[model samples]
Target: MKLVWTQIKNFRSIKDSGKIYFNPNLTILAGKNESGKSNILKALECFSLDKFNKDTDFPIDYIEEEYPEVIVHYQLEEDIVIDLCDTLKINKENAHKISGVTVTRTSEFLESIEVDIFKDTLEYVIDAVGEAIKVINRELKRTFKLDINSKSSYLLSDLIEKIDSYLLTIKEFFNEEQSNKLNSIIEEVVSHLEMLNGFSDYISDKKFKATIPNFIYFSSFEDIIPDSISSNEEITPIVNRFFKVVNQNPKLLFDESNPQRRRLLSDKISAGISGDFMDYYSQDSVSLKINLDGDDLNFFVYGTDTQKPFQPRQRSQGLQWFLSFYLTLQAEMKTGSVLLIDEPGLYLHASAQEDLLGMLNNLSDKSPIVISTHSHWLMDPNRLERIRLVLKVNDQTQVENKIHKGADAYTMKPIFSAIGLGLNNDISTFGERLILVEGYSDYYYLEAMRYYFQEILGIKIKKFKIYPCLGSAQIINVLTLLVDSETEYFILLDNDKAGRQTEKKLKAECGIDENKILFTPVKSKNTSVIEDMFSQKDFSEIILDSLDTNKFDKVLVSKKFNERMHNNEITILSDETVSNFKEILDVVATPKFSHREN
Candidate 1:
């Protein structure tokens, strides 16, 4: 089963009832900060726990303290259809029984003699023929007057009038011997006319019907722990209660009457939870070693370390989160569960983040996963369909979220293709390969170089798209996602320390071949697009080396731009030349007067 959709009513920043859809594979929630982005997940967690209230951390009121309710709608896959149907009160074959019947009876006299009074008389025939001929002849004349010219048309029209005028008289000419045959012909013609009168009613009745989804809930605790600890033996009952509700176990986890079942659990604990590199070790020290002998149940973690029993409370915050997520996933796999994880990348390393994402993706193959995060490192470009941007519009009360799924990524600044000649989307739409770049200058210079190569060398270099991110910090994540989906991405970052480090990280993380990436040569340390231009005086000479940058910088930093920047007309880097000049001054001067504090 999978969570198909969710509805929220007056929940925290959410003012009215609204629905958000979920894909079976992944559902990503994105927002700048506290736009109540995490509220929906928190609500689902609350519902899972079957404990929701105003005082809860999952705030259900933005303007005032209002209790809001959330409903999660779900559907089961084919294998679990029967179980789901039972849960939703659906019986596919048990439709409302239609047993009552409408009565309609007739005697032979009423059926035959009464209706026979209005026989196929000449008058009746004349009236029906007159109406039919008028319609057919009028249409014929309007449609094909040229084909049925004067003389030939006269015969057709005269015949029609004759048949209409003598219809009653002609009917009287027939005896009882031929009456039945004529009656049959008349009935057939009437039936044909009835059919032609209007369209079949089926068109209006044939339509698709929608099925309302089943409702379910998922709950979690900000701080989940036992309320009382009377004895070491009591720990089992509390743990059992929590696990029973959590896993939705058919039999109670704490059913002491079933010793055989308890033995199975004990056996499982003895065998241990072992993986490729680790094994679980547990000890009931408080029960077996201390006064309350047969009471305590102690759990421990064992991996790349010595043997020692540890309580769940003593584990690191990160470890607790991991184990909780792991157990939750396992339970969900058994019950066809949907998972909602908020800021899952918290305390996770870059490698671990990728592994966790993969694990989630794998589990999602069975159910659905909805994640909310602020980390760009968690974004998978190939899984762009799962990303959603949450925004608060007009006021602080309502949240507006937009889901992007197409092949394009939006940026305020202009982006160029790999060759720096064409626009970003144009290349992505047309090119077969891509070279991801860093910023605007690299994009502009590449476009100009592509033009030179095409014009002077007659080389076809427009077959590539160049994507310019502000930095290569997200390149590994982007490449990891795209490469797995069979998209070829080549990096062309600067040779600076940060850029080199980014390249190394990308290779280590994504296993991308070095040959595919086009790193700037080490010998050309001072040969960057920015540096190349700074070493020149006349714009004409500078244009010879990188014509695109020279033109863009000169035109972009003209008096018009200076006026706008000086008057505070444009805020973000109003003039490229001024920006570049600032960078140069920073590099040369001792204590540079930089606009950027960093």
Candidate 2:
């Protein structure tokens, strides 16, 4: 069975809501913080619950004293319906039955009776008499056998004929509409009750809790393991034991921790898994164990031999955050639960962050994963239908609100732009390819070049988008975005001192693979730049060659001067600002072609 729709009223930030359809396989709730995304999730959790804990406030009130209610609707398999019916004690005669046959037959009988009755007002009176005769006929049929000379039957038949004659005469006096109305009333009174056995069985069946399966969530940051174990042991036992509890029995997750019992284990377990995994511990391949002399716990991290435990708060904020979520994933797997992770990419190295995203994608096939993050590195546009945007509208606004599925990167670009989120664009639109330019000159230059290329080559290129740093000083920011996106970048910068410094900064700060960057050679001899200026120079010569000699002579101050000297701004050339060379001026004049390209 899958939850098809859910509605909430006066619940926290949600003043009112309508049906929210969910994909059974995966449903994601995403939005900037405080958009009521969490509230919707909470409502789902609340609707399916048997009881609310002390942490929860019941009957959430948003309008003065109005109580809020949440309703959840689900679609179940036929077998699940049967199980429900068996559990709810719904019988064949109960209203919970879903079949339509019995109800339809009863309706048809009533409709037929109404159609056949009194033809007019006069007929209505006659119909009453006809009804009396029918009743007498029924009595006769029940009380005695029909015989040639049964005096009692004959008397009843004579009375019925007399009534029928009066009813026919009266029918001729009344309008047809009035007669039909009267007939309908009579038919309704005579209709039998409908039997709803199927519905009863289905509705009365036992309710089963929806258990969403779980997946892993890796954090983005990486940290160095301390050289010496601080009185620590391996985390193998703790990891294995936690998974055992989750897979074996998830209910224990809800149980309050027994401080005394846990303390005894803590001396040997140090930071053993918490939350919902303690109850299902079964000896598995994963070995979770205590470390830091029972003060910490560690778990296996791929591509490494020794287990790493949680770090001290002062060590690294990102690592500390990551460890918490990593542990949560391990715990979730054991309980067959869904994972709800918020921002798993905090404080991690770029490489580590990419690795984390890869890990999560792999785990999603096994279980549903719901992550609320601002990082674009984790998004895969082709697989974006699972994404949902939670929009929070002002209560004062008299407008309808809804949740929308994110279709692709292009679809979400405007939304990301509104929130100042460059990450989403980098992931969905640019992917792993980047073009880093020094400033707006490069930005506009690249754009212009692209247009020219498309027209010249007749082949469109849109693999990578150019990112213009405000200046050479912002190269580090550009590099970080590129690295986080896990793509190589081509840094096109001016060959000036500032540009060289920019390159050095990226090299020292970023230390990414050499293949990731495509830089210029430092020496003047290596100035074989693949630039638009050189191309423009060739194009300029072609245009000068094609122009009328007389037109050029009129524009040039001295025909004997070299073509280069006339083109240079320093030399005296023409009185008019416009040039005889149309190609260059035409390109510059056209708004579409004038923009710069990196």
**Best-fitting candidate, scored by TM-score:** 1
Per-residue lDDT of model 1, residues 115-202, tens digit only: 1111222234334544443443463452311122112212223433444343343346455664454565555445433322211121
lDDT for 241 (candidate 1): 34
lDDT scores of the candidates, listed in order = 0.43, 0.41
| Cα RMSD, model 2 | 23.9
Instruction: State candidate 2's TM-score.
Output: 0.39
| TM-score, predicted candidate 1 vs. hidden true structure | 0.40
If scored against the real structure, what TM-score would every candidate get? 0.40, 0.39
Tell me the tens digit of each residue's lDDT in model 2 across 169-256.
Answer: 4345446764564454444322210112222223233433232111233323333222223223453433433445435221232232
Cα lDDT of model 2 overall?
0.41
